[model samples]
Target: MTDDARARGLTRMQEVYGWKPPEIDGAFFATTVDHLFAEIWSRPGLSDRDRRLLLLGALTAQGRMETAEIQIHGALHNKEMSEEQLREIALFLCHYVGWPNGTRLDTAISTVTARVRDGGEPRMRRLK
Candidate 1:
């Protein structure tokens, strides 16, 4: 990837996550910045908010709450989504993604929403 793309990706990541990659895993970090953020995320068709919502659904469906939490927090932090919207998505997913998966995500969403309303920092910053 070009230096500019890499830089922009890193900036975006930091803006969303409020943290940087550790130096120990530079290659993995570089690929995430260069490919995932710069290449894939920079694509034109979807808005950032749309991507965030889609990612929330995909992550919840896949039962990846750890990662989903990050995306959820990002969505709220960026004001791309609201708690009611997330709750609606969870309810909507129940028919398609199953009740168990939807409930799992709803639990996580509740936790994050409470944190935000209580003026606490997101757990994503503490994630490795």
Candidate 2:
């Protein structure tokens, strides 16, 4: 990948996720920065918030609240969404994705929001 793509990806990563990723070596990481963040996320049509909502839905549908929590944390940290709004999304999604997944999302919203409010580091960083 071009240095420009990597640079832009890191910048867009901070803008979208509210943190910088540590340097890592892997084809997955390369594609993530070079393509996902640099190209898809930085694309013009959808705002970051819009993309975040879509990601949340997909993650929830896939029973991936652990991953969803990162998005939730970023949304709360960056002021892209309010706790109430996220709660409402959980309720709305329940009918579509199933109650279990919705509940999982609600739990993640609570956990991530509390951490964000309490000035805790994002769980993703802690995991690393």
Instruction: Provide backbone clash counts, one per model.
Output: 0, 0
lDDT of 1: 0.79
| Alpha-carbon TM-score of each model against the true structure | 0.84, 0.94
Candidate 1 Cα outliers beyond 4 Å, as residue runs: 15-24, 125-128
Model 2 scores a C-alpha lDDT of 0.89
lDDT by residue for model 2 (1-128), tens = 99999999988888887887778877888888889999999889988889999999999999998889989988987888999999999999999999999999999999988888788967773321
Writing each residue's lDDT as its tens digit, candidate 1 over 51-116 gives: 887888898889988888777877888888888898889999888889999999999999888887
Leading candidate by TM-score: 2
